[model samples]
Structure formats: structure tokens, C-alpha cells
Target: MINKIRLAIRNDLEASAETRQFGSGWISGFLALVASIAGLLLLLSQRYPQWFSMKELALIHNQTIFSFVIQSILVIAFLLALINLVLRRNKILGFSAITLVFASLLIGQLIDPQEQYIANAYALGFDWFVLNLLLTGLLFIPLEKLFGRLTDQPLFRSEWREDLFYFLISSVLVQIISFLSLSPSMFILETTGSWSGFRLLVAEQPLVLQVLEIMLLTDFVQYWFHRLFHEIPFLWRFHAVHHSAQKMDWLAGSRMHIVEIVGLRGLTIIPMFVLGFNQQALSIYILLVYLNATFVHANLRFNVEWLKPFIVTPRFHHWHHGIEKEAINVNYSIHFPWLDKLFGTYYMPPHQWPKGYGIGGHPVPNGYWKQFLYPFQKKKKTK
Candidate 1:
């Protein structure tokens, strides 16, 4: 009831504008507003029920009533705090941000009943989705603004919508992606059901050692996979979609070929399975993989000076994506730059960055759907 009344009063906040000013302040407020709306919609999708079906939820199963109540309180508190920020800073929205949130919640509630729903498992995790979005937005937006390589680049650049679509689609299809990535492991387990004893050696090692070993092994195993995508003519067609992103940012890494994701992830996990790391180590590696992948592709101008000789960084990976003829086939390793150096594929220069990016002559199409269908279409002279 309180939410309904608030939305009614806040409807005026949505005044359409023919034009509006844009600046750091506007960007900050927009981020906060979007995050608030995302968090609220996720909350309502559950509290109201019927918003998400039972089968759609994949993260936590059998959510308790207390858990649901606590979650709702946290989301509401977070939204209220955004209003507090606005008032304290005299932001564009003032208390209107909170009212808009309330309005959204009210409309969402009206679409269904208010009765709470709980489940043991398979509950749609719109909650975690919103949290992840807010956390990444808060963390990376500042990093990019302060240290981004392309200082003059607008936050909203060319292909931004395409990358955003890729990010959202990947998030929504995470479950399917996970299952497909596990296909190789499942196949190996099925074929060699009796050889499970080998994994014990890996499992017996200390957890830290296990993680270290997996890291090195993946760098070695996946190196060839990365290189193969470049050397193989047919495969390069699919991988080109990833490099097609002319602009680089935290979100840029998510623009990947669906086939590339399934194949590459599936192949990379084989080492973990064959070597047999414990569940904890495997989970940590997965988290690190995600963070590192995003970080290396980010637009931030981070200088890892002395560490350049050891591991991959934004400078290292960006070179790989450079359109320069000399760097067209270099820097294939994802984790250790040393692997590239040893194999003779490493390409870097003294305090220099790529002047351009993307395929030199081949122009890829726009939009996520178009790019997805691009590899199948025959194009003359793919280089």
C-alpha cells in the first residue's frame, strides 16, 4: 500500500525531455538510478510471485520465508539510501529516485499477487543478478573514468548496445552455458569411469598447490586452443566476432561467439577434471577466470610494469586484439605471457599501445543477432 501511494506521486519524475545535459554527475546519477531499478525489479519478481516461473530460477533452491523477508528489506534499504544520496548531494532526482523505485515495485506487484513464495532450490536468482550488476557498475565505472586508456572515449560508444545485449544474454543463459561447458568433462568421466584413481593424486595436494597447478596447466592446455582459433581458417570466422568489438571496456569481454564460449570453456575445463582439483579449488579458479578475463579486456590504463614479464595484463591482451599486421597473430596465452614468449608468438613493444583494433580488411556486421549468423555466411578473403 505504501509503495502504491509513493509510485502515484512519483509519476511526475518521469517527465520526458527533448534534450538533457550529460556529464560526470549525470553518469553517476544514471548508474545509481538503473542499479536501484534493477535491484527493485529483482525483489518484486519474487515477493509478488508469478513474475518468474519455478523452472527459471537456478541458483538457490528452497528459499526460506525469513530469507525472502530479509532480502526484501535489504533491497528496499538500498533503494532508500540512493534517495538519501540524492538529497545529500542535491542530485537531479532528490527524493524522486526512491519514489520511482516505489512506483516500479507497485506496478510489478499489481501484475501479480503479494503472497510470498519459497522454494528449496531452482529459485530464479534475479537477486544475485542485480547485485552483480550493481557491484560491477560501482567498481568499474570509477576505474574507467580515472584510468581508461581512451580518455576521450564516451561511456556510450559505438557497439555499446551490442555488447550490452551479449552481456545480458550470457547472464540469462548462464545455466545453459554451464551445462554445455561441462559436456567435455562429462564425456571424459563416462569414457574412463574406472580411472578415477588418478584424480586422487591431485586432490591429495594442498588446496593452494592444487590451484597453482591448475592455473599453470590451463595456461599450457588452453594456449593451443587460443592459438588454434586464430590459425584455423574456419574457426577464425567465429572468433572474429569477439575481436569485432572496436571499443574496449569491462563489458567488451562478454561479446563472444556462443560457439566459441561453449567450445573454449568446455575444452579448458578438461585439465581441471583430468587433474582432479577439489571442489573448493575449482570454484576459486572459476571466479578468478571470470574476474581476470574482464579485467584484462577493460579499457582502464593500468600499468603492470614489472609484472609484464610474468602474467597477462590489459596491455598484453589488448595487443593481441590490435589490428597491426605485426601483432596480428601474437600473444595467444591468456594467463602467462611467458608461454607466448617461449613459443615465439609473443609481440610487445617498449611503452607502446595498439593504434587500432579489429580485422584490418574484414568488416563485421553490427548487432548481436547479425554477428551470431555471420560465421555461417561465406565471405570472400577472410583475413
Candidate 2:
């Protein structure tokens, strides 16, 4: 009996090894494809600048095929290191290497020529990446450890590559859309007017007051739109992709359907346009929203028993992604807790975390484009 058990364990290990090997090969192939396309586009942009159009050339210039190549190389190296560490059961070295890579990327970005990259690369570095890494490591790391102890599931044990792939694809799509949509007059209108308004708003307010106003307004809009997505079945299908994530983390927030992303942005901008908030206020608002949204979805735990009634913390948003029927359509607020409280949708019973996450029954396509068109597809028969 003991010999049979040993044999079974050995077989399981072998299978797991084969699976990892397959996944690594797949990732390598995909990266190669990305590199090839980027290289071809770069060559075309250089040799046939007139045929390619200014925007097309700018896309290549802004992302700089070089940056993508570097990122891909780093990702491959990290994956190989991770596999070795995992097989050797060396958690400390694994995490240390991961942190080192992230820090190195940040340092590289900081020193790079800002003009070589798109606006978002700079925005990502200064506005989102640095603050998030610091906050996550300081606050979230311990919280995740605590959660792991309680739940028997490591809060941070999620597939980072999947998250990275989603980001790369979405970013590529966004750049393509921007290139196709570019109009000098429209650019002037968006940048000059909206940014000017954002600046003026912050200029008049105290720093603390400015932060408060930005948080309140952005969350208020996000709450309503989030609820709308749930209430309307058609919209729900697209939004459902977000809820489909079986695991939650800071990067999990990027799983949103492309249409939902564009739609939500359009919805959020209405108030910004009509009210005319200055660029500073807008900048601060964007920064706060991105950070808070990342915070709430992060693999963190906070013993803020008193604050739960006011702010939308990780505990609150986890319930929003809860797999249970009663938990569905609850906890809609993005930052503010009062909105969900007012609507009576907030559901976080004491001493309980959700059994699982994702839609209870409905399954969706996995491919990017298929998921993009999912809302328009015929509904599958629900079990």
C-alpha cells in the first residue's frame, strides 16, 4: 500500500512538471509572436513613414519596440526563476527575485527618456506603480499573510503572467484605438479644456480638501455605473468578465471587458466635462481612483472594524465578487461605503469571507476578442 502511494505521488509530480513545461512553452511562443509583430511594425514605420501615417509611426515610437522587447525578456527570466524556486520549494528567493525585477523595472523607467514612451508609461510610473508597490508591500503583504492563515489560501498566490498578459493586450488595443481615433482638433479639445479645468479646480482648494472632493466624485460616479451594469442584463454580460476572475488581486482589476472599459470611462468623463474640474484635480482624481480600486481588490486584510461602515475596503469589495447567490448584486461602491449602505446592498456578515469568487453558474469565452463580443452573443443555458 505504501509503495502504491509513493508511485502515485511520483506520477502526480511528473504530471505537474509536464503542465508547467507546456505553459512555459506557450508563453514563449506568444512572446515571440509579439516581438515579431512589433519588429515588423517598427521596420515599416522607419522605412515607409509616409505610407504608415504619423499616428502609426508614433505608436511604435511611443511604446518603442525596444521597451516591449526588454519587458518580454524580463518576464521570461522571471518565469524560469519562479519555476526553479517553486520546484525547489524556495519561497524566500522566489519572492525576492520577483521584487528585484519589479524594482529594476521601476528604476529603468525613471531613468529612461520620457519622450520615447507614451504618456501612460510616465503616468504609470509616477502616478500608479511606485505608490502601489510601496503601499502593497508595507500594508498588504502582512494582511495577505493573515488572510492566508485564516482561509488556508494564500492571498497572493495568483498567476501574475495572466494579469500581465491582460495588461499587454489591453494596452496594445488602447494604443491602436488612440491611433485610429486621433484628430488634432479633438486632441486639443480633450487635453487643453479638460486638463485646464482639472488644474484650476485644484489651484483653488486646500490639498486635503482637494483629495476629498476628487475621491467623493469619482467613487460616486463609479458606484452608480457599477450598479447600472448589474441591473441591466446586457451590460451585465460584459461586466461579468470582471466578476469571472476566480482569484482577486491588485492586477485582477485589469480583467475588465474592453467595451466595459471604454463605456465606463465615457460615463465617468461626463461629470468631468460638465463640471469642468481642472487638470490637477483630474490628475489627483485619476491617481486616487486607480490606487483605491487597486487597494480594494488587492489581496489584503485590514482590521479596520470601525472604518468598514464608511469606506469600501478589501473586505467589502470581496463580497462584491462573492460566488454566493445572496452576495450577488451587493457592495457596489468603489471607494465610499455609504452608497452601498444607502441602497442596502452592502453585505459583509461578521466572521465570514466568501466561499469562492466568480459568477455562480454562467461561463464565458476566454479569448480576448470572444469576451469582447460576449455581450452580443446569445445567452448560454444556465444550470
Q: Pick the candidate with the highest lDDT.
A: 1
Candidate 1, residue 372: lDDT: 95
Q: What is the lDDT of residue 61 in candidate 2?
A: 41
Q: Local distance difference test, per candidate?
A: 0.71, 0.59
Which ten residues in a row are the worst by lDDT in model 2?
121-130
Off by over 4 Å in 1: 1-25, 44-104, 107-128
**For residues 1-383, what per-residue lDDT tens digits would candidate 2 score against the true structure?**
65764444333333343343443332233233333333333333333333332332344544556456546645754674465454543233344345445654665555443354233311111112222333544565556656632344432244444454565455445544333333332445575664665656656777667667767776788888898888878778878878877788766777887777766776666555445555677677777776777778776665578998888888889889988887888999987888887888878888577877888664876656666778788774321
Query: Tens-digit lDDT track for model 1 on 1-383?
Result: 77764453233233223122343233334444564566465655555333342334423323566346534644564555464454433344434455556665566557543454444233344554555556666778779889999977666666776887787667655656777898889888789867768777779889899888888988887899888888887788888999888888888888999999999988889888866788999998888887888888889787879999988999999999888888788998888999998999999897898997788775789888889998888854355
In candidate 1 the C-alpha lDDT for residue 260 amounts to 94
- Models, CA RMSD each: 6.2, 10.2
Candidate 1: pairs in clash: 57-123, 57-124, 61-120, 61-121, 62-119, 62-120, 62-121, 63-119
Clash pairs, model 2 backbone: 197-277, 197-278, 198-277, 198-278, 198-279, 198-280, 199-278, 199-279, 199-280
> Each model's TM-score?
0.79, 0.61
Ten-residue stretch with the least lDDT total in model 1: 12-21
